[model samples]
Target chain A: MAATKDPRPCSIADALALVGEKYSLLVLREVCLGNGRFDQLVRNIGAPRDILATRLRRLVDAGILTKRAYSERPQRFEYRPTQAGLELEPVLMTLMAWGDRHLRKDDDRPMVIEHVCGNELAPVVTCRACGDPVRHEDLAAHPQVSGWTVSGPSAA
Target chain B: MAATKDPRPCSIADALALVGEKYSLLVLREVCLGNGRFDQLVRNIGAPRDILATRLRRLVDAGILTKRAYSERPQRFEYRPTQAGLELEPVLMTLMAWGDRHLRKDDDRPMVIEHVCGNELAPVVTCRACGDPVRHEDLAAHPQVSGWTVSGPSAA
Candidate 1:
């Protein structure tokens, strides 16, 4: 593993960098779903014990998760998402929707997301400018920055 | 490092399992912005060379990005986002908006995103059922399965 570099001081980057790891989202999803115990996360995600521990610690360090002592006998702790972590629910839902649409083996029956409104949900993006729902073709490249201006093997 | 375990069979889990790693979103962001070469990614992100290579390969495998050979003499390759990858631009834009609102330093201003209509862009989520805009608090939770329930841990 490479040394964890200090993240590019941007919230989106920080948020993604923090919860962007393979196990982090799983851990967060479980916690959001009300599963917070070490054993519960391990059972729910089937991630390794050490990896779960490290991810939980990282989440706690980032303030996305908080750990509370659950028992003293074995010094057990349960992880819970903070408000910041709950904010990621939308992002997770979008990712879930993408996966269901493109990667699911059975395209007809993908994972279901129910809105609090008693409605089954599908991920949707809308334009803030026009209050119009944005379809794929609705978006065109803004020329202020041309593709080639930022294009190159060495510009990243 | 811990062994990679098979995540849940759900699409959400599968998607998260794929692009949920560190620098993955950053890599995707760069690709969406049209930075395609390995050296450009390295220059933009400052991620380790090996890690960048691995991520580029993963993106290509996921169909979010495609690699094209641009030069035979230097044996150079460039990455471009496929339609699937372009669909994620809204998500990335939303993430950027969230970051700009919550994460920017006092002195630094993030780049502005404007629609082709010359309107400033902001992230907005829409309700698929009624085609109405949905606010964060307006969402109501409805569980499809008996075992799956929504509850706030803080409430408990």
Candidate 2:
């Protein structure tokens, strides 16, 4: 077998390999927002038709989405998130909140989410075990891959 | 002026427009991991040299990273995250956590994080005001753009 080039395997890299294609997350955004039909996704996401179709197919194949026939006459289908895909919603929420804070002024934000708490949702990432906000400085990384360290591949 | 397309604005789309390019988030990952030198990023990220160079330049231009001169003779530089860039670490964390959960088995996971509370960090998105875990069924989205609704564009 060919020698493993990057022995430091990363799940982030793996996840991106699956959904990092252009407009993939946008498709998820549309679906999660209760617009799952092809036409709605095309209009809302504004991705080119062919590209949207491809991304949808890829997402479905990855099991992040399920396609079910919603129209009998024309066999039109709508996409729904699988359990795995629903778990990605927070990723979108945090990204949206970050963009809202950094990229746009309050009045110019294009969407607002309201949590069940009856307040405008401001998504924050927190550690599950301790309920502390996850910050770069407050965490340490351990490389689970053999021959690797947080700095880089461990010295051979 | 060219006709406006995608007039129903979205900050998520805007954010993705900036960082959603291929390998962009992975670039952020390496810098956040403190492996910001060009060669270290190239080796760790496994991106082609020219492409990685382009990505680094783009990230620098986008204000997510600052390039600082580190070596005098050869004029070597390293990348560091700016405030906006640091804010994006949570997105990376959530993505990594999702990949770990959905894509990798327990024994095969590549990295683990330890939070300041001394437990393995499991990142969860929660509502900032109420401190409850954010879930799909417990939130409502209100479109801020005029002539738009959660389902799509309202009848114009």
TM-score of each: 0.77, 0.92
- The weakest ten consecutive residues by lDDT in model 1 chain B span B1-10
Q: Name the best candidate (by lDDT).
A: 2
Pairs with steric clashes in candidate 2: none
Report the error of model 1 at residue B80, Å. Answer: 0.7
Model 2 per-residue lDDT tens digits across residues A1-156: 533456247888889889888889989988888788998888888889999989999999999998988789989888888889989999999999988888886567888998999999999999999998998888778887566646631211
Candidate 1 residue B65 C-alpha distance from true site, Å: 1.3
Runs with alpha carbons beyond 4 Å of true place in candidate 2: A1-4, A152-156, B1-4, B152-156
RMSD of 1: 6.1
DockQ of 2: 0.59
Q: Which regions of candidate 1 deviate over 4 angstroms?
A: A1-11, A68-77, A108-110, A134-156, B1-7, B71-75, B105-107, B131-156
What TM value does the first chain of each candidate achieve?
A: 0.72, 0.90
iRMSD, per candidate, in listed order: 5.1, 3.1
User: After best superposition, candidate 1 residue A143: deviation in angstroms?
Assistant: 13
Position A92, candidate 2: lDDT = 95
Model 1 lDDT tens row, A28-110: 87787677888778866888899988999898998888999878998988888777777666666677777777776665443
